[model samples]
Each structure stands twice: as structure tokens, then as C-alpha cells.
Target: MEASITFGDDALAARAAEAARELAAAGVPEALAAGDPTLWGPAAESQAADRLGWLDLPTTSRSLLPRLAELAERAREQEVEHVVLAGMGGSSLAAEVICASADVPLTVLDTTDPAQVRRVLADRPERTLVVLASKSGTTVETDAHRRLYERAFRDAGIDPATRILVVTDPGSPLEQTGIESGYTVVQADPRVGGRYSALSAFGLVPSALAGADVARLLDEAAEVRPLLALPEGNPGLELGAALGAAALAGRDKLVLDASLSATTGLPDWIEQLVAESTGKQGRGILPVAGGEPTGVPDEIVAGIATDGAVRADGPLGAQFLVWEYATAIAGRMLGVDPFDQPNVAEAKDGTARILAEAGEGPLPTGAPVLVDGPVEAYGDLPADVKDLSGALTWLLSAIPERGYLAVTAFLDREAAFEVPVPPDASFEVLTDIWAAHDAATLQGLLAVRTDRPVTFGWGPRYLHSTGQYHKGGPQDGVFLQITGDVPDDLPVPGRPYTLGRLQLAQALGDLDALRGRGRPAVRLHLTDREAGVRHLLAAAREV
Candidate 1:
């Protein structure tokens, strides 16, 4: 059956079709290496594009639908009220999509946040089901979350083995964990990478349990495969190729949007996918996550220098119109050959190594106050990072020649209540404490570019605005995630739910939601109470 197309605008479809053809041709190797040698490269480009064609290998993701339906039935039979998907990257992205788009309330935990662990245990009812998803059966985040859940189950007098669900490749570490622990186990496709596993049971079953119309999603995905295979007027392939070319050309980042619950794992997933598939040499698309209404980058000022000078030279001077046009003009500029990014594989290997070293089959680091700073932004800050003061000076000193900069702050409930915000419908749920910082930051960003409007919101609150505006909105925004490490971790009173564990669990949930949106996200973990106010002040400064 042909997937139904809505939005009821044929004119728009026609316009997109015209642009898509040009883009596919540009990204396609044969078309690029025409009579004009300068138009494209030699043999490499053709091979690269040919390799990328595997994106369409699964002509139809038919199996996921029925599996999802069956999982949904199982959930109903068990009367599961909530599901916590414990995995990092691809294992979790598909689950995120389902949870976000589905009618039910679901949460994703991708971090070892003590606060989050406490919250989940406190909130988890007797009917809660924990799905441990790790394709290779070894991801630190997934293993950690699974252990936390298992511990909770044992503490609550519930059989740990009976309370958990396992999804991974056959004979994988996670599968072994399930078998040894006596949990129900399901296998993922061995041929699929974590990034591509979204179309497999890896993504679908969790989404089905979360209440998404998995059957419709399967139908939607199936329709795209053939279109992508054609390479002309195919949005998926065109987008992937275009994005790949853009990364090769100079644009290094591609921010994506997704709902809070379902799409939380997308950032890690996309990061792995694009980084592994296309990050050849020193080039690759750095995918980050953002939420709806809030995650959208309010402004993209390309030429702002550290010295406060705006130079319109070289590609820096190019306008958004040019970027838009180039998307179709250049297509997959890397040619038709594969661009193997070994670092991508290495990173995964490292994670596996750490997990395997643990004696407990699927054990991971327990929840903590914080994870290390961003791998990319490690030394970017100051030696003494007690508060926001050092962070501000760092931003001013190392301002990009022409790149995006944002401030992320974590405010307490009281502080959040004092913040102001826009009149948009999405901000209604945001408490005053959270709005105070968002409003102040938005104002500061706007001051630099009054012509461009700003978008902002609070976490756990703006999640509701995800559906129509995020994945559906215009894709030209940057994101900054500001959060605070709560001094006192909240825990479930009197139970096995420890405060530190709970905090970590909730933090992971918050982070996964933002990551799932697929945008450029920087986490600013405030150290103390004063750090929140200081962070707001730092955001207001012009570097």
C-alpha cells in the first residue's frame, strides 16, 4: 500500500521534488564526475555513494510492526504502566521515537544520574517494566540502568529476573545478562549496526510498548525505502547524502528534532551513525540533540569573532540561502565511496571493553553527580571550574571565528520560578524558576541579533510541545543545554531507592530527551547554588 501523503499541498511537494532531484544528482557519484572533472572527483566518489546505498538495504521494515504489536500485547498482559529503556545511542533512539509519538507516557534513561534513579524508583509502580537495550549487549549507560532497575526490583520484593526485558543480538553481553538473570530476552539483527537498528526490533518493540502506532511507522518507513532507492525525489537518501556532502564541504553540524520521550536517544545514535559512516579523515557531521520549542537554535551568527568583529570573507560570508541552495547543488560531494571513520568504531569498542571488565555480567558505573565534561570541550573551560565565572571567561577567550555559542544553566526550583519567558503556548508549563534563566538567556542572544527571534523553554516541561514543531519545524537552529547538579538528590522515602541513585536516573531521563532531538547540545553542569545565578549572568555577556 502506498503511504498516504498529507499536508495537502501539491505545490510544496512539487517544489520539494524538483529540489530533491538536483540534490540526489549532486550527491550521486556518476552525475558529479561528468565531462567537467572539476564538478566531481575520480573513482573514490562513485564507490562512496555506492556504499551509502545500503541505507536502503531493508526495502521494507515489515517485521518490526508485528513485533511491536506483540510487545504491546505483552505489556498489556503484564499491565505495565511505564517502561524505562536503558541503552545509549541507537539502541535507544527508536524507543524514543515511539515513546514521544505514542499516546502513552514513557521515559528513557541514558545516563548514570543519581537523581534520575531516585525519581524512577519513586515513580515506578508495581507494574513498571524495564527494557535493557544494548545491541552488542555492552553499553555502560544501558548496563548501569539495568543494574539500577534490577536492584530496585530485588529491594521491592519483586523478582529481578521477572521484572526486566532484554533486547540485544543473540549471544551478546546483554543477552547473556538476561539469560543468567532469568529475564525475558529478544534478539536484534546481527547485521545491523546500532545506528541502523532503529528499523529493527531494537527500536520498534519498545516504541510499541510505549503506545506508538508502530504499524503506521513501519508503513511510513517502507514507503521511504523505495523512494530513497530511486535517488530522485527521495527525501531520506537525498537528505543523508546532502547532509554528508554538507559535512564534507564545511558545515560540520546537523541538529535534529524529536519528541522528549521517544527521541531522547537519537543524538547518540545519530552521532554514531554519521560519525562512523561519513566522518572520514577529519570531517564528519556532529549530530546533537534538542527538544521542541526549546531546542531550536534561536540564531546562527556565522562571522562573530572573538574580537567582536564580523567578517564577511570566504564561506563565512555565505548566507542561509546559499547553504540551502548548496544542499541541492552539491549533493553527496564525497562521491560514491565509503568514508570509514575508525574513531566511531573505536569509541564503541572502548565502551564495550569497560563493560566487559565488570565481574557482574551486565554491570555499569552506578549513578554519579556528574559525568566528565564533553569529550570535545574538555580543556575548553578553565582549570578552576567552581562556578560560571570561569566558563564565561573561557567562552570569551576561545570564541569561534564564526560559530554558534550558547549558555546552559541549571537553576533550582526557586530560581527557575523567578525567570521570565515568551508568550508562546509551549512555555506555559515552565515554572517561573526555569523561565527566569531561559528568558534572560534568550534576551541576551537576541541582543546580539535583534533581527532573529529566539526560542527557549524548561526541561521536563517543554516536552509536550515536541510533536508538530520540532521534527516538523524549519531545521536551522542551534541548542545549548543548561542544567544544575542538584545538591540534595531526591530519593524514594524508606525503600531501596537511594537518593544518589534516583538523581542519576532522572538526570539520565532529562538528558536522553534532549539528546534524542539530534542537535548541537552542550551540557553546563552547575556546581553550586550560586552557580545558577552566575550562569545566567554569564549568558548575558557579549563575547
Candidate 2:
């Protein structure tokens, strides 16, 4: 019997097949034809070259190059003051990358916060240009902001079409909206996903307009392409597949995201792609990203590092303990299935509500009323909300959710009296205490403060509001520093700090400086000798 034959795009097939063979030869088992579907995909392998082949994708993204050039020219002529980018996820990531890399005066409003939107608009004049970006054009968040801006333009008696630019797929709701509104619609590449679209014009145009050397960036991306596609020798594909394989082998996968901005947005895009695409079947990877930016210089790491130190023993018993887990998270993103933690969303919602209540209205500041069970833990909690903190953590531990515990203190009677005390105000007071106690513990502690059971965060959503709180708040918090001090030391790599040490130091120091004015400070060092760190964490339950 003859084998059934499939034929179409013969040239494409041949090129992809040759590329696959090279990948296999280079040691990419995923490139090899395996019966296990988790190990490979013809579509992914097939698109490898073409995706990276674009002349413009390296410095500028494929999704936004041409339009950026046009916008730049227009800006030069129109003397445009501000460029407001609208969208979320991929739609915004590309623009963010471009703006970060560009020379233009740009601001990306990638939030659902009405106050944030009002602030951006209020900061800029009515003439500022708005770029409404959405891959599907149906994103509710983007649309909400669009409505606000559309009203602004209409009220100012400006032609909305000339002032607004829309980026979206053809035939999407956003495209229809732009068309009906008489706005210019720049169609994104139909085949490009949001994360992958960064190399497309989607990200490049805005970045270039903001003053980044987009062409050079694309050049760099292009340079990496050939290297990435080189069979087993290709670092990108090889690294990716190997990491995935390692996770599949039961090793913990962790991605140490040492980027300047902890939640700057790039990691989110990469995380999604790595997680959704690679995590197939029940046996896939478990991806995670960690940062301990407490010891290094703030400016160097975009201000993530500060004064906190990892403990000799405790939660962060050793830098390696966290490192190994980080490696596991990276592996999981690649394809390893780390034990899945549960109820992430519910925990986030509770945290949000807490923040919102504190920021918007009267907080429940009664006093620590510890009850039996989980309430007895966290000995140094305040009288007003001690139970709240313990209850939040207990609920988080009880289920699968993303929980975070923060204890802020205001030593200055004046500062404490400041209007609008947040519900978690006391939590902030303990920042240095937590950071000093155990930077790792503080990190993990925050990960467990939820009304619902929490395991870990699926993405970086919770980190968005942390920066402003760390930097802009009144000097009234001594954060507890915690870290597992096992594995002795981390490789410092030519610099004054190891990647791990740098992370821990910077994060701690910044918190220290933020509240060092008059507040008393304390640092706790959690020992990670043996399973002592976990034991301490478990002991918290008994507290």
C-alpha cells in the first residue's frame, strides 16, 4: 500500500524541512520528528525563518514600522507634543518596547484605572496625538480609554480622524470603530500574535518615534535569527527546547527576570507565549519569574534594588534555592509542569479590593483581634487590621490563589495621620521588617496574603502598583527583608553583585531609603539550612 501524500507550498515545506534537519543536527530534539506531540509542532518549526527574515523587524517591529516612520515625519512637521498609546497585552507591549527604545515624547496608558487615564490626559494638552492600538479591536479596556479620548477630541472641536490613529486587525471591532469614527486604521499583520508582534510595527513604530534606534534594534533581532535557527547550534531554539525538556525532566524551571522595570511589560508578553504554546498535555512546563532587587543601585536596575539582604537561614536559606526554583519556572514556561498552584484570580481580586478600599474610602482599622486557627500567626500585626492580614493569608493558603501580604507602618504620628490611610497601610510599615527578616520570606509572604487560597502568580499583574508605593510613598514604612540563605553564594559575574544578590539588595535598599527618614528599621535573616526555610514558613501557620 502506498503511503498517503500531502502536498502544498512545496518550497515552504522544503525550506522548513531543511531548517528542521539542521535543528536536529544541532541537538534540538524537538526539531526531530517525535511521536510525542508535546515535543514538537510542524507549524512552529515551519515559521521559524520567515518570522525572523524581515528587514524591518529587528530594530522596529514588523507590526508598526511603516506607520512609525510616517508618524515621525508628521511629528517633525506638526510639532506633536505627546503620543498616547492605547491597548493591552501584545497591542501595548510592542508600543512599550518602541517607546522605551525611541526618541519621541510618548506615554503608554495601559491601565484600567480611570484616575490614571485622567492624569495622563490632564497632563497633556488637547492637541496630543492618540494611538488606539488593539490586535482584535474588541478589547474592552482599550475601547473604554478610546471613548474618553474621543470625547476629549470632540469637545475640543478637533477632527478626531486627524488626531487619532488606530492599530488593529482588519475586520475587527476596533477597525470598524475607527472606520466609522473616520480615524486612520493601520492593520496589523494577520498572522502575527501580540507577543510575537513586538518585532513587527506594532511595537517598533511607537518606540522609534520616542527616540529608539528601531532600525538598529531590528538589526539586532535579525542578527539573532540565523543563530536562533541554526539546528542544535542555534542558541534561541536550543535554549528554549532544552529548558522545556529540563522541566519535562522534573527539574524546577525559574526565569530570573532581572529587567530594569520589574513589570515593565516585556516579561508578560514572553511569559504568555512560552506558557500557552509550550504547555500542552498534563506533562508540560511550569514557568515562573523572580526578582530580589534589594542590594544593588536603584538607577542601574530601574530602581528595583535597595538595601535588603538574603538571610543566612530561613525562607531564602540560599540564593541557589530560589535560583533552582527560578530555573524550574523558566523550564515550566518552556514545557515543564511545576506543581500547579490554585485560585490566582480570586486572590488578585481581593488584593485589588483591599487597595481600592484603602485608596478610595475609610479603611477597617479596628485593631489586631487574633482568633483561633490561622489568626494566631504573624505576631507583630497591628491592632486595627491584624486579623485581616492573618485571615487574608489563611484563605490564600487554604486554596489555589495568588496572595501577597504587606505590612506598612507609620512611626511619625504626623505621617500616620495623613488623610486616606490605605487598608494595607500597616502592611507597608513592615516593608523593611519583612525585607530584613527575610527578603525571600517577604516575597513569599506577599504571595500568600489573600482571601482565597493562592499558590503563585500566573503572570506579573500584581507587580504593577508596587513600584509607585515603594518609591513615592511617605517615609513611614520599615519593610521586613527575607531571603533563604542556602547554596552559600551566587555567581557575581564581573559586577559587584551576583544576579541574585543584586536583585535582593536593590529591592531592600530602595525600601530602606523610602522609609528611613524617622521610622525604626529591622531586618530578619531567614536561615535556609536543610528544609529550615520551609519549616519556618509552615511555622507561620502555627503563629
Candidate 3:
């Protein structure tokens, strides 16, 4: 199951050629293959050597095949009906790609939304094995998820220890927690970062539990490893160089065209890898996956081809290795640290600050208003389409040339748009009206108005995916954050904050981070989620 890579235009091809020459001169290919720290440039001394272990995951995974198979067999013997992975970013996305093709039922819960959390908890706790995966072992969302589920299991008269698994670095707090709670603990390599750990234990454990062919995946990856050793003919190096060159040439948008049948959720997984790995220090690659192509001048398209029409033998593993290697090379070319997430901490810090300031009182609120610039409204605005239309127009008008608009929604996922609305009132309403609006109208409207790309990301989820690029990459994004009050909020077990509050804090924190970086941003809070969505859609129609 070999894969092919090609550029969408000649400009990208020429850039790849230039990048290949520069990478060769700098010995990037050899340095990467040898796991040399020099690949990190001036920061080589500060970077961790183990972070480079992902480069040899193919060879290393071969050694763990037996153990992975044993885990799969154990799960089958225990009759675990569902495997739920509680993780974020690198820890969970690759597992998702693998589980999509697996025979076992697997659900990756990465969102902090209370509704999403409840949905996962509603699953048969007795028959489900929850895998707590975090590379750092201190991820807030993962920890919170573990706490909530642990209580849920206890409430259901089931001991969580018997049905829980922990996958993390050796001696991490999570490993200790799992051991203390009498849960099975799987130690991942301490050197591998979350996004790059798809070939490591962090990925394989869940993949195996989901009944995937872990051995064959590693074998396919091993076959592609040799090609990555060369600077010129290496697919990884060539792709990386092309992306770096494209970014340098002001075509920073790396649009991915993946076969849904061949690579389920692979594009989303790549979105986080490329965005987080290369986006930093005011330079980054914005990965647009499965979105309407804006056909903008500053866009480069990359296609992923797999073996079969519906199922492939080894495309997932091959893709994991290719993108991981390419992202490392791209980081070098962009002159940024691929492994370190400097800006990601800012949002986390902001969330902490907000949590500290939060008291027993109700959450803070602001008045709704319409202004000339990016509209900052609270609760519900006037139903008159004119006022909302004016505000939306102003926001759209502010989009600069070559700039893009990111619509981030922080509404409750469970009941986002469950209102008494007529089916034929405007357009047919889907379960997620916000997504429908963004897909059917919002993106096209904004694209036509600004002549730029339009991207829509749901709250906190995008924080792990594109948040890195938003704050650390070029400050050319116009951010519109949509947040609303949840009808019924669920509290985190033994914590002062509820999941609703936590979700809002995350949304506000990231918004503050963006604004702190001087990025153009606006917030629209809705007391009524359905009405606000309708108003937004009506405004889009006016445009």
C-alpha cells in the first residue's frame, strides 16, 4: 500500500526544489535520521533528545508488537464492549484515525464540553474500558475527564479500577494515579511528544485495543523509513520543503485533500500535527482540511491517496510517519521549534487565572450591543435583521486582504439548537445548526465578502488543533468567538467549577490570548442559542 504525493501547482514544485537544496546543504535529512539535536537550530542544546524518538517509531514499534497483541487479546477476553480514550491533540487524534478502521467500538473524547462528557458517560460504564492518555500526565482536560468518569463509575456501583487503563510516560503523575487506583498502567516513551507519538505506545495501545492490525501498520511505516533518509528523493523531506517554501512565499494555507473512505479523520489529525508543530514565532502553516476550497491565490493543495476505495491495509501508519517527518523538516525550514509549545501555555495560564478569580457567584455577563467594528454582543440582540446585519457587515468589512476569518463556537453541543422552529421557516435545520450555517452560508458569505478563506472551528476542540497557529503564527486572522449559556450545566465531581464554566473559561482564555497578541477578535454571547444562530444566518443572507 504505497502512497503518492504531488503539488497542486508549478509554484509549489519550484519551491520544493529550492527547499530541497537548502535542506541538503544544512544536512537536515541526515541529522533527522540520525536523531541529531542540530535539527532544532540554535535551540538544539535546549531541546530534548527523546523528542526525536518518533523518527524511529517504525523500528521501535516492531519491538512492542507482542505486547500490543496481548493487550488486544486481554480486552477481547474481558469482553470490553467499548474502548473510550480520554485525551487531546497528539495523544488521541492518531488513535482516532486508527480506531475508525478497527472492528472494535472505540470513542475518543477530546472535548471539554459537558454535553460531550455526559454522552461518553452515558455509555455502558461496566462494559467500557476508559484509557486515560496524556503524554505530560498533567493535561487539565484529561485529568478532569478522568475525575468525572471515575465518579460516574462509582455512582453506577462499578469499581473504575477494574475498567480503567492509563497510558503515559513512566513515573508521570497519571501513571502513579493509575497504579494508586489499581488500574492497569501502560508506560509510553518519555521522549515522544503527543502529536508525534502515533507510532509510539500512546497510539498503539488504543489502536490494538480497538482491534487494528498494529503489526502491519508498523511494517508499512518501516518500509517508508528508508526513503526519508535521503534529502532529495525523500517524500517527507520534499513535502516538508514544499510546505516551508510555501509559507515563506506567503502561501501559508496548506489545504489537504484526503479520501474519506481511505483516510477517515486523517485530515483532522494532520491538521493538529502541522498546525501545532510548525506554527510559532509569527510563522506557521495553516492546515485546511475538508473545507470548502476558497481558491485564493495564497493557497497550496496537497492530496493523500490510499490503497483501497473503502479500506486500506497501511495508509494510516504510512501517513503518520510521512507527516511526522515532514513536519519536523518544515519546522527546520521555518526556523521554529517543532517540539516546544510556547504559546499553548498562555491559554492554560489564562484559564488558571480565570478559575482562581471565579467564586460561588453566578458567571459574569455583559450587555448586548451593535457597533461599527467587530460586534461584541452579550445575550440576545434585537431580532430585527437590520441591526444584526449591520454588525455582521462591519465584521466582514474588517477582514484585510490576504487575511482569514475564524468562527469559534462555544455553545453546548448537546442542545445547541433544540428550539421550537419550523422546518421550512428558512432552511432545513440539522442537529448542529451552527455547523450547517458555517458550511452552507457563513463560509461562502465571508469568502465572497473578504475574498479570503473562511474557517469554522468548534470551541476548545480547535484550541488543540488550530489554536497554536492562531496565536503563534502570522497575526492575520479575524477571530469571531460565539459563546452561549448552557440550559443545564453539569458540575465536575468534587470541583468548584462545572463543565460549562470550564468550557467557557477555555473559550475566554483563548480569546484573551489572541487579543493579547493584538489579533483582531470579537465575542458574541447568546442567551438563546437557537435564536442567535438564526440571527447569524439571517445576517449572512443579507450579505
Candidate 4:
């Protein structure tokens, strides 16, 4: 359960050593441990003061044990052992890993895709416990989810108050709504920021309900927590120095090696934490959730697997605490406020504007420049491009030397892709092909074709995570947004727009925000999900 870090390369080791020397000389570790908000300078002091409570979460969060246990027991007694968590960003990511590591069931609903939403509704509501989590209580996606679930439960003749649980900061908009609706509301530490709340109530509540060993996680974190205070020997500080050093040295793209985490999906959590915290003022670390990608000279390999110098090994709790601390340290080194996401609102505003302009008409889905079988391309394309292969090649060529290509898919992530391996094919081939069965295939295909990092995320979920970095971070990024025509668009219970429209608007909103910033962006509309994905896979492979 002890967390540890070691260097595997001379460059990383030397750079980390230099960074550690400077930080130690400035008494940074001690200042951070002492809760000195001024360490981030006068500009960040006010926000830092309200965001440092995470440092104490390992021990302070233990008080929630009895409450979490009682809720779990109550759910079991009611034959509602299934836990459906509706949250975005850090609120859900922490609990996700916790449950995955423990081999428990947790259904996470963090998307605006109606297909994903409908899939969750198919789960028997009477036997489910829905946890509504949002720090601000006003996140458009979370709010929409809350409204849908409340209706779903009521339709099942189950009182939402009995089946629902809420987690948010005290005085948050959700807290008031939860109280008014007569649901159990667990107020988290307001001082802890969303991404740093891995050890707080936001993390423990859903995980404990889903049968994770919540107390043991805290114990593991507590054991490694004290070492974070030592400037030189601290694992967190060392990792931070290495990360900062790597980014400053022009290797800012972090390719995650999942060999260490296995099924825990720790890299996905780390991706949001680092990207959102450090990406600001036209600078940030872009986390690529994949193993050591070849040919990207600007890529830095780190995570559980591989012999990378910047790696972490430990239990989930210790892993969470160390990464949170390291990200804060990296933020300081990057000269940005780790607590604030300055540009996250741009897409939100765009989404609202697009929705408002929709009025009583159809959502504003712009015209596509090229339409090939089941695939339509939006945004300006290179002249004389005849087919999907040509279009993909042009998109790959748009990425700058140190820039990255991002693929955001507004589709169901869990849709089954049953790849039938040939009798002569190896198991590895089956698994590999299954991975490329969706728009996500673009990441691997495009990475091998270009000398830049490629990142892929299921949409709307990322709008609350890496979406901050995409627009606010380094301006060198080129984006590929993939949207599909929904087979059956479901309407929002009380809202005017359907889930399909909302998702398309979310995609359209992001396209506007990225293009407005002068970033090269394109949209690929999948006219048919299965056919489009296959065509996409084939075309991307050719790129």
C-alpha cells in the first residue's frame, strides 16, 4: 500500500533532481504542507486558500465511514444493491477507480448522449440506488441527469427521496434542491477542489455504496500522506518535479502506460486532474491515455506500467493522494492556479448560445463539406480530397510538430463490438480490433501516421474534464469531433430539446469554441453508427 517513485532515465532523473533542489531551496514542500496559500503568489492566494483542504482528506474523511456504511446497508436491505452514479469530473472519477479496483459494479452516467442515458434507464430502477453528485449543483449535464433520473424513479412508482442520494458542497445549489426534494445530501469539504476530492465524501460515498473497502483506502492514503511533506524524499514532490521538468523540457504530452493500473483506469482520472489543473494561460500538460506511443518526440511516458521514470505504484488511495499532490506541485511550477478552470465556460456559453438560437427550430448542425457513405465531413477540407482516406490525411497533416490531435466521440462508449477473430487469428488480434471498433480507433491509427500525440474521449463527459485544457492550454492543438445520427432520439422529460439534439449541440458548441480560438477543428458526422464506425476504422487505418 506504500506509494513509491523512481527514475528510469538520466534526463528525467537529472531534471527532476534540479527541480527538487529549487523547490526544496524555496521551502515549497513545507509551505504546501503548512497550508500556506501564498506559495502560489498573490494572484492565486485567495483561490488556493479555498482549495487546499484535500491535503487533510486522507484522515479527515474517516468520519464519513459510519454514514457510508449505513447507506450501503440500507440499500442492501431494500434489495437495491445496484449503484448508479450520476456525476461529472472528479466527483465520479475517484469512485469509479475505487469500485473498479474492488471488482464491484458501478454504473456511471456522465454523458448527454441519449443512447447512453436510455441504456441506464433500462437498468431496473426499483433495484437501483442513484447518487446525484455535482459540486456546484448546476452542471448542465449533471442537472439534466438528475431531472431524468428523478422522473425515471417516479415512473417506477418509487419515491426518488428514498432511492436517491446527493453529494455536493454545503450551500451549493444541489444541496438546497436535495433538501427541498427530501433526499439524503452529503455535504463535502468546500475547500477541496473537484479534481482533488478523491479522498473526500465525493469519492467515498458512491464507492462505499458499491461495496469498495472505503476505510482501507483511507488507511492506505494515511500511511503515505506524511511523506508528502518532505521536499526531497517526498514521493509526491519527486513526481511533481519530474512532471514539471518534462513539460518545461518540451515533452509535455504524457502517454499513460496502463500496465500498472490494469482495469482500474487510473490514467483516465490522472488525465483530467493534470490537464485541468495545469492547462491555463496558453500552457498545460496534455495527458495521452495510452502506452508509450512511438515517434512523438514531445511525448513523456508515465503511469503504472513501463520502465518510465515518472511512475506510481501503490493502492488506490495512496495513488490518488500522491497524484493530487503532484498535480498541485506541477501547477505551481507551471505558473498557473491549479484550483481554477478559466476557459471551461467558453464551451458552456457556446452550448447555451446555440441552444438559445435554436428557438423552436431544429438544432444548428452546420452543413457538411464532403459526404461519403455513412460519413459526412464538416469544416473546410483540403481541396481535391475525394474520399475518407484523403480527408483523414488532410486532418492529420494539420497537426503541428509539438501539437496533438484530439478525437471526441458523441456515442455510446459501452456499445458492444463483438469482433469475430478468424480461425487463424491470435487473441491479441481480436482484442486489438475490438478496440478500434469505434471512433476511438482514430487515436491509435492517427498516432502511428503522424508524429504527434493523439487523444480520444467520449464526449460531454470530457467537456467537464480535459475540455478545460483543449481551449485554454497550448494553442497548437487540432481537433476532430465525431458525432453520430442517433437511431432514436429521446426527448428530455421537461426540456424542449431531445437528448440527441443536446449532444449535437454540445459537439457543435465545442467546434465553435475551438475554431473561434483559431484552432483547426473538423467534425465527422456518422450517418449510421455501425457502418460509420467501420468506415471510420478503415479510413483511419489508411491515414
Query: lDDT: which candidate is best?
Result: 4
Model 3 residue 191 distance off true place after TM-score fit, in angstroms: 1.1
> Which lDDT tens digits does candidate 1 get at residues 65-112?
566667678778978888877776667755674565455577776544
**Of the pair 1 and 4, which is ahead by TM-score?**
4
Candidate 2 C-alpha lDDT tens digits along 1-543: 110112132332343345435446544433221112222234333343333222223433444556678777876575667878877665665556445434345787765433345556665555478888887676545665677776677677776777788888779998898999898777766655554566555665556655666665555455544333334433333233334334433432223342443224443344434443333333333233343322211100111111111111111111111122222323334433221212222323443344455553433233323543222222233445344334434433433222122332111112112234346657666553333333144244553332311112211221222222222222222333322232434332233332233223333333334333333322223333223333434544443
Q: What does candidate 3 score on TM? A: 0.89
Question: What TM-score goes with each of the models?
Answer: 0.60, 0.52, 0.89, 0.96
Candidate 3 per-residue lDDT, tens place, 1-543, comes to 674456546767787888888888878788788888867766754664758888888987787788777777777787888899998888888888887856446888887877768878988877788899998899888988999989998999988887788999998899899999999888887778888899898888888888788887788788888888786667788778877888888888876666644657787888889988887888888887656556677776666662211111237777788888888888887889888877888888888788777676655444556532233464233344246566566667666777778877875444444445566665545534545533234555665666666777766777877888888888888888887667778888777888889888888788778878676676776666555665676666777
Query: What do the candidate models score in CA lDDT, each in turn?
Result: 0.45, 0.41, 0.76, 0.86
Off by over 4 Å in 1: 1-61, 64-67, 244-277, 286-332, 335-341, 344-397, 402-432, 437-525, 529-543
State, as a TM-score between 0 and 1, how close model 4 is to the true structure: 0.96
Ranking by TM-score: 4, 3, 1, 2
Q: Rank the candidates by lDDT, best first.
A: 4, 3, 1, 2
| Model 4: per-residue Cα lDDT over 428-461, one tens digit each | 8867767767567667777788777888888888
At residue 185, candidate 2 shows an lDDT of 77
Name the better of 1 and 2 by lDDT: 1
All candidates: CA RMSD (Å):
11.6, 17.4, 4.4, 2.1
TM accuracy, model 2? 0.52
